[model samples]
Target: MARGRSLSGPLFLLLGLAAGITVGRRWLDVVEVRGGSMAPFLLPGDRLLVEAHSYESRRPRPGELVLAADPRTPGRELIKRVASIDDAASAAELRGDAPDSSTDSREFGAIPLSAIRWRAVFRYWPPQRAGLLGPGH
Candidate 1:
């Protein structure tokens, strides 16, 4: 008869490494919905897995929702729809041609691409709701 042995040192180390990688990828690498800035699409507490990429590489589309750092609150993240990019829509807003209740650089100022963390593709959580997020214009 043989007695069960405790976890070996090497096994414990590997387990720890795996856990760390998973946590790092989930928490540090992904973005979580924290406010109603993206309401009707994403709600607070919703989790999104952000892929590692350069924000500058991808041009902001008209209806894509993005995760950007809040200029008013440092270290805080915000999710908002990309009303427009390249200052075209902004210029239009200046001319009073945009939406009446628009949420864009006009209110928060133009944020750099580096501040963006990810482009939300879908919402997954709360069990009742989960699906691809369509363009919101």
Candidate 2:
């Protein structure tokens, strides 16, 4: 009985840790910025913490940063700000801070809402620019 009790604590801890990791991976993702599209705001190499289930309950709103599948390139993802939402079309227009460097809705037209799965909620890398991503940041 004593030996069983001692093992139970560590076993439970390990199980909990495993469960946490699984849940985290399912709902969260780390994205590394690659271009100057969002420059002056989000620079290259900036790592962002994106929430996969962010749009599960509600449609994305304007001004929010999001990660979406690139329409031009299959299997590729792009991070940009929501420029506008078209409820009638069930699509959203995305734009980067630096228009000159971005290939966004302006080039591809509005993207279907279903294509957008992740919302960029925070910046976690580089230490100095880490914080919640939103207006006035």
Candidate 3:
């Protein structure tokens, strides 16, 4: 007895796409912490997993580590701690600022949901520190 089968063009294409999406969503896209902007928690060379999802799925709370687009450097991304927001009360209490305000003082200003690439889910590498890196609070 002999059994043989070959994938057709359409089936092969579909399989390829499914595989691509799975890999892209799970592991293809990743970022590494490069600055002390998010110090005391994340350090340079820390690999982070980035998955494309609804920006509004979860709100960025204070002290949470996030990967955002650097407004000053178009097309570039940065990793920083979410310290404040555009709210007067939140800023004033957490940071102290008025509405329509900016949180981080770096070249980039407030990061709209669109500017956010991904939230730091977990810290990889260095062996010693392997776990979630959410806000201190």
Candidate 4:
């Protein structure tokens, strides 16, 4: 007969923590604002808690903010508002509040649902700007 040795308590706990962190990263993410494109709303240096799971059930509506992968710059991301959606085409148009200075869907075309990483539900940084983003414009 052979006896099996299971993971020790601390080791198991560490493993669980690692797994949770990985899962949590995929389920939720955090992003920081670095530009003024979304100014007057989201400012430079504002940190936001991104709910990565929010769009798994339904598409974001117009005026709702979302964090999406930048089409022009791979590995980079952008935070923009949902401008329009085409269910038939399975794509969404995104726009920055400042159209004149923004490089958004107008230049990049509609982004696919897969590119939308998260719906920004809360602004958790800067303390002064901490608040829940209310429904649509």
Q: Considering every candidate listed, which one attains the maximal lDDT?
A: 2
Clashes of 1: 0
- Each candidate's lDDT (Cα)? 0.54, 0.80, 0.53, 0.78
Tell how far residue 39 is off in model 4, in angstroms.
0.8
Clash pairs for candidate 2? none
Better of 2 and 3 by TM-score: 2
- Across 1-137, the per-residue lDDT of candidate 1 in tens digits comes to 01133445434534543564486664224456664545555667886544434354655566766777767878876666765565542311111113353355677677665565566654445535544456663
| 76: Cα error in model 1, Å | 0.7
Q: Which pairs of residues collide in model 3?
A: 91-96, 92-96
User: Candidate 2 — worst ten consecutive residues by lDDT sum?
Assistant: 1-10
Positional deviation of residue 91's Cα in model 1 after best superposition, in angstroms: 12
State which candidate has the highest TM-score.
Answer: 2
Candidate 2 per-residue lDDT over residues 1-137, each given as its tens digit: 11225556445634543564478877776779999999888989998767777689999999999888898899998888999999999999999999998999999999999988888876657767655677434
> What is the TM-score (0 to 1) of candidate 2?
0.81
Instruction: Candidate 1: give the clashing pairs.
Output: none
Q: Native-vs-model 1 lDDT?
A: 0.54
Tens digits of per-residue lDDT for model 3, 1-137: 01123435434534544575576665335567665544456667877655545345755666666666666778867666666666543221122122223335443345665465466655545546644454563
After superposition, candidate 4 runs with Cα above 4 Å error: 1-23
